[model samples]
Target: MATFAMTRERIFRELVERSNRSGNAIWLARMIASWRVGEGALPDYLGLSPEQFNNLRSHCFSDIALPHLAVSGKTVDYSRMLEKQDLETLLGDFRAPDVAETEWIIAILVAGCLGSDHLWQDLGLWSRSELSGLMSHNFPELAARNNKDMKWKKFLYKQLCEMEGLNLCRAPSCQVCQDYGLCFASEESTSVIDQVERNFNRDA
Candidate 1:
């Protein structure tokens, strides 16, 4: 069997290569690549299991991306989220004096929320409040980077809404706001996103 480090390295390299070949955005590629490597190594590094890694990936692709796409009006084709040209345009439009910090925030949010189970389900019921709370408590640095007038919950909700409007989530939902009712259930369901988020929060 390959050593954990070696497996992680291989997985990372494969993800990078695949992303490059598919013309995936660098940031998106990095996010997935990290998960691919981390999922493989985390079990050995921190006593997780292969099943957990699979669950993490499932939650990410489904719960995180699904609701996001619903709200953002974005469509994902195959395994691709943002097209290369569109991603380039977005990167250009959002250019800042400190690009690194912006990138870090995006990366952190993608890693934390996309891989989380809690953010998905019945129209992402727990997403806004719980995730906002988690960010406020665990990632104060991220919270500090936002404009002073922006509250964490407000920021997260706004971003999610924007992403939905942009159709970045996959297949965007078209119903008018007033016509839509919450799709998520108040109680726990057997959703992968929910399970992973619960596990992550407990571990933290």
Candidate 2:
């Protein structure tokens, strides 16, 4: 397992390096890679049930595009939000620069533990700047080329589609789809994004 973990970390590091990320982007990617290796060991270390982790993971994704609505206060408490020390332990060698970064890491881990099986809905929790930082770290090459005016989610979806060779169209096929407006233009999505941004910034 240790050897496998090293190999995975090396692969992610090589990918990040090959992308030519620099400054905070490079640092963030390195930290994320290092932390990712400890994922399989998280349940044991945190004294968390793998089953319960999976259950929370389920609420992270949904075809309805309102996963956050599913996250009850009880669910948040049950998820056992990690403190700075717990994040440090799970992160191992990679040290987060501050509390915000640590919490960001925790959010990513929580999203992962809950399962990244669908298009990410929980990312709405992050503010514009926070999401921008993530784009820089996770998709440095794409992030560098993105037009500043582009919404982070749009940039992310575009990059993902390009990477996977997927042609995600919102014409005839997507127009009739339930999630059409969620990813594209819709009042609901705009409201949700605005609300989350306000909440995140206010808390910050």
Candidate 3:
């Protein structure tokens, strides 16, 4: 049994390494993360056996691909890829009213900023007020519905950092819960949400 497990682990690690080199590791990791492999059978969505899936989950690490994902490049405009519908779908799983909108907005903003080289210059607004105005124009109902008296820029920055942390710690075998380390009740995980909240309050 021990030998079998070891061999499986080796295979999983090799697969991950290959994926990292191919620059598809982020996509692969996201697929694994979405499947929630620890609790049930490996879904047919990935077309891998239960044992193989579990092995990947147990051995996979974000360090292999997260840095590349986080860094900005000229090839693709990541910000433009952050569609509002996608953000809504991603945050739909969250139950908390206060946190959900903020989280979604953050994800959208981070996805936009991360891939833009001249983010500041291109956007043409450094202060929170200017940024908030832009957000209000782009996502009109968001602020009015949330009823949160926070500066949009600071809130956006806080949320983006939290998203980055979440992206960094994401793995199939992560100690953190599926809430992406944002839920307070997840004792097994580190909550980047708390850090973002603290930063927001400080900036406020």
| Weakest 10 consecutive residues of candidate 3 by summed lDDT | 34-43
Query: Which runs in model 1 stand beyond 4 Å of their true positions?
Result: 1-79, 83-105, 112-116, 120-130, 134-179, 183-204
For model 1, residues 70-123, the per-residue Cα lDDT tens digits are: 222322232443333333333334434333233333333432332223332212
Model 3, stretches more than 4 Å misplaced? 1-85, 88-111, 115-124, 149-204
Better structure of 1 and 2 per TM-score: 2
Using TM-score as the measure, what is the rank order of every candidate, best first? 2, 1, 3
TM-score of each: 0.24, 0.29, 0.23
The lDDT of each candidate is: 0.35, 0.39, 0.35
- Per-residue lDDT of model 3, residues 1-204, tens digit only: 344334434544544664533222333333233222121112232323344334443344424322222111222233454544444443343323432123323333433343222222222222234344435444555544324444333334444456556444355633444753332221212222333345558999
Better of 2 and 3 by TM-score: 2
Candidate closest to the true structure, highest lDDT: 2
Cα error, residue 18 of model 2, in Å, equals 33
lDDT of 2 by residue, 77-175 (tens): 424534424433434333334423333344444443332312122332212454456545544454576654354445444544565577776556644
> What TM-score does candidate 2 get on C-alpha atoms?
0.29
